[model samples]
Target: MSEVKLVLSYKETIQSKLDERTKELIIHAKNASQNAHAPYSSFHVGAALLLSDGEIVAGANQENAAYPSGLCAERVALFKFGFDKRDRYLVKAAVAVPQIKGENLVPPCGACLQVFAEYRAMQSTPIEIVLVNGSGKVLIAPDIYTFLPFAFTNRSFKYFI
Candidate 1:
């Protein structure tokens, strides 16, 4: 057995460290957050995806009466993007105000991260991610691989019979 370390690095700051395009997407995400249906948890989340065509699509978390039926903002946005533009590649995605009051920036859940990994793998290029809060805190990941190293992909089961 050997010891291995997984080092994950990202920027955490109050200032925007992203390009103008990403900043604009984050603004849409923040606006979308206001319409989230989070009566149970009261944790509204918003996600915006930037397409190569320069179009931005936003989604807000929708919670169902049955707890397990809830869908996260990231997936809601991404899945719709995929359905609408299966031929297009997502350039980047921005999430806004995941925290209750913007103290901490919330990251995607495990399932969402996996979906991000698969979505990125479907295209030749990588998709950038930006996490921001209304309080000015921001977190940026260069790509999906940054958040989930050794992420499960088509290659993960390529050898299976």
Candidate 2:
């Protein structure tokens, strides 16, 4: 077995300097947080996706009594995009969380990353990730793979074929 290293790239910037589209995503993510149904965790999260078709889709975390049945905001938004425009590509995604102290930015979980990988593979393009803290500070990752280092990919099995 051989070890390989993957390098991820991203940028960090304050809210004021963000591009219009990025700003809009941040706003949408913040607003979506208000609609989160997270009674169990009391941790509200929101996610917004910018599709290649110039459409924006948003989602808030939905929790359930069963616990495991709950879904993350990222998946909610991503799924909406898939359901609405299965053929379209997802260009970017922004995630925001509301906290008692203020706002915080949380990265997508492993499961969400996998789902994003599928979309990225389908489109043959990277999906940008926008992370905004409660303070409105934004961090932009040009590609989700940077956030998911050593992620599983079909390319790994290409040698077998």
Best lDDT among the predictions, by candidate number = 2
TM-score, candidate number 1: 0.90
Give the total clashing residue pairs for model 2: 2
The per-model lDDT (C-alpha) reads 0.84, 0.85
* Residue 141, candidate 2: C-alpha displacement in angstroms: 0.6
Clashing residue pairs found in predicted model 2: 103-134, 104-134
The residue-by-residue lDDT of candidate 2 on 15-121, one tens digit each, is 89998988998899889999999988898899999888888899999999997898999999988988888878888999987563344457889999988887887
User: What is the C-alpha local distance difference test score of candidate 1?
Assistant: 0.84
The numbered model that scores best in TM-score is: 1
Cα distance off (Å), candidate 2, residue 27: 0.7
RMSD list, candidates in order: 1.8, 2.1
lDDT of 1 by residue, 29-146 (tens): 9998988999998888999999998989899999999878989999999899988988788898888874545567788888889998898888968888888876878888878788
Clash count, one per candidate: 0, 2
